[model samples]
Target: MAILITGGAGYLGSHTAVRLLEKENDVIVMDNFTRSSAEQINRITAAAGRAPEVEDGDVKTKEDLERVFQKYNVEAVIHFAGLKAAGESVEKPLLYYRENLQMTLCLLEIMEDYQVKKLIFSSSAAVYGNCESMPVSESTPKNPINPYGHSKAMIEQMLEDIAQADPAWQITALRYFNPVGAHPSIAVGENPAGTPANLMPILLEAAAGERDAVDVYGTDYDTKDGTGIRDYIHVMDLADGHIAAAASQKHGFHVYNLGTGRGTTVLELINMVERVSGKHIAWEAKARRPGDPAENWADASRAERELGWKASCTLEEMCLHAWKWKEEMHKNTQKGE
Candidate 1:
């Protein structure tokens, strides 16, 4: 039975695919290349010394998923396929609900039919919307403020309910904080299409002159630098966490928060990126984005205790590697143009 990674060419999925390949695990990648790119798959091939068997498919289609399962003896699934733009989800709530929720439901149904029970659910910390408390644990009350986050919450709830109904299913939900940085080799990273809403990518764009300036979401926030604070974990660490969760042979739906247990304000992150890229980041203070929290970090102790996984990369490392990818992608875009 091989491991199947949905959205395998995406930012986080691409990194995870390379790691799983490096570990000599059989991996099958299913991606539609909607939110991801073909270049990332090429980088994964370069990193792994071979390409994972690709299924040009989407999880929203059950037959597309079934075809992959039939082609490969899929025993476990790492689900990462979904629309993830929080702000956009707010604008188009129906699209978010239909795409995110339907995809998970369809995937779960097919997985059940195929008896492929093990699953590593891709979740987000956004589910803990506007967290008034610092350092949230897995047990934190979920109050997602955006449609995108609500979709993830719905999937988590679905996973819980499914696990409860069946003792045979082994599932673990990994709630991620802000995942930044590229792989150590800088081969594959967050190379999102168009302007990225995520913090690091926007900062990289401004520093690389892809954008005129980075917009600081809010300056009146109750943070050390008057900007929103977030726990940024390296993408490599997040990929490793997925591996640990997949390997844990535990039953029932267990959830873990993956983070470094530290927070870096938006301004501080910009400064670090500037330090790494040696490019001054121009900025404009903007109004607070609705549904954004002032601060959010993770108590990753549960992940450490259960999956024996903890993030080890520093903020400096995140900035350095992110800069590396940004520089490389910028050059590639120029070459293509």
Candidate 2:
């Protein structure tokens, strides 16, 4: 009767857990705490008014996953556990493949063993590689140029094959665009490990004086401002999409693109963040990151029509929410001293 969330201590997973709790679904959080923190668990408990059933275990381990399934009468799973650094995936392709692909395989096997059929996977837009058009649809050719993207693509394929073999399996792979921002209360937000590989987190760090300056990757791209353009969706919106997909009466393997259906360039995002935070963001243009796309937005009609979900927040709202979270984190750190 509980929905199990892998890596529930993470940013998006934690936000999704909050939403699930809001809907009155009992949540069982499974995490190894490798790249996450216990502070997130505390925050989710505070926001949701109840602590989720926490299971400290790795998804890659069969015993670990099985134990969790046995302990909690898990009805479904929202998988968010995996390595996500695009650049690092290129260098450590084997590690990426082993962690991402192997973990999914292990989890699926356990799900089968436990007879839990419903699964909602957290996929990325990186699976699309360099899209031919601006607004990418679900039918776009999946020619992933990076190991990270390839890993996600492989998982999608695996899910399809699994569903085809068994008719009872209900799988939904949500291909997410760039997810930014935080919960409105500033109770929880992204906490990246080491230097963040994503633009939004890096920009926020620069604004908070945690970093020297933000590096604008590839300013020569053929975009509105000669910078890369990406569809930025709020973390909360992405979380809502996952909940909708999980509760759907529909069956079989399906994929949905989650985005705002509009593109924002790197420069525009930087300006918006600065304006929202009232902080000067020092930035420098850098060479293009390999496997980077010139522009990528989602044709989110499927999510709108099928799931009855559409992003309602604006770019300014996303930036303002993220700034508030960052500012609160700073004040909390100072107060603790």
Candidate 3:
């Protein structure tokens, strides 16, 4: 039986598909290229030295999903289809609700029909919106502030209920922190469409001279350098966490925080990128974005203890990997390849 990855051409999904393919798993990728493209599949093929069966389909469409389920001997699914921008979700709450929620609902119904009971959901730390504590854990109260986070929390609850109702269903929701960096091979990385809302991508853009200056939001926070601190995990480490989740024998619904369990300030990140990329990052101070947290890390001990997974990449390594991808992409664009 093969593993079916929804939105497999995306940043995280592409990396996970590469890792699964490298592990010799029969993998199939289903994507419509809404936020990604076919080039990601090419890169995945190049990196894994093998290609996954590609289905040009959207997760929200039943016909698109049914065709793949009819063709492949699917054993498990890693759902990564959804709109991710928090600000955009806030601006278009209905779109977020309709797209993100409907995609999962449709996928779950089809999976039930096919008797594919194993699943690994791509969730986010935004579900724990503005926590009062330092490091967030799996048990953190889910108080999502925006539609994007609300959609994720609602899907997680739906998965929990379904798992409780059915003994055969095995589900894992991996709540991810800020996933930065790229694959060491420079085969895949976080290259979002349009202006990126995340800090890592923005910093990379500034380093690549695409943007004029990086905005240092809220420099008066109580962090060591008076900047927001976030737990930035390498994308490959996150991909490995999914592999561990897929290989687990544990039953029922499980949730794990995928992060480095450490925080890096904004200035600290800028310094690291400059040090690694040899490019100076110019920045300007801006007021705190409304809903932005002062500090947010992760207590990923449960993932280590349960799934035998821990993020081992250093901050410098993350910066270096991301900068390397940016540089490579620049060269590729110049060559018009």
> Top TM-score: which candidate number?
3
Full-model lDDT for every candidate: 0.91, 0.92, 0.94
Candidate 3's residue-wise lDDT over 187-304, tens digit each?
Answer: 8777788888889989988998988999998999998989999999998999999999999987799999999999999999999999999999999999999999999999999999
Clashes of 1: 0
Q: Which lDDT tens digits does candidate 2 get at residues 239-287?
A: 9999889879777899999999999999999999999999999999899
TM-score of each: 0.97, 0.97, 0.98
Better of 2 and 3 by lDDT: 3
lDDT winner, 1 or 3 = 3
TM-score of 3: 0.98
Q: How well does candidate 1 match the true structure, expressed as C-alpha RMSD?
A: 1.1
lDDT of model 3, residue 16: 92
Q: Model 3 clash pairs? A: none
Superior by TM-score: candidate 2 or candidate 3: 3
What residue runs in model 2 are displaced by over 4 Å at the alpha carbon? 335-337
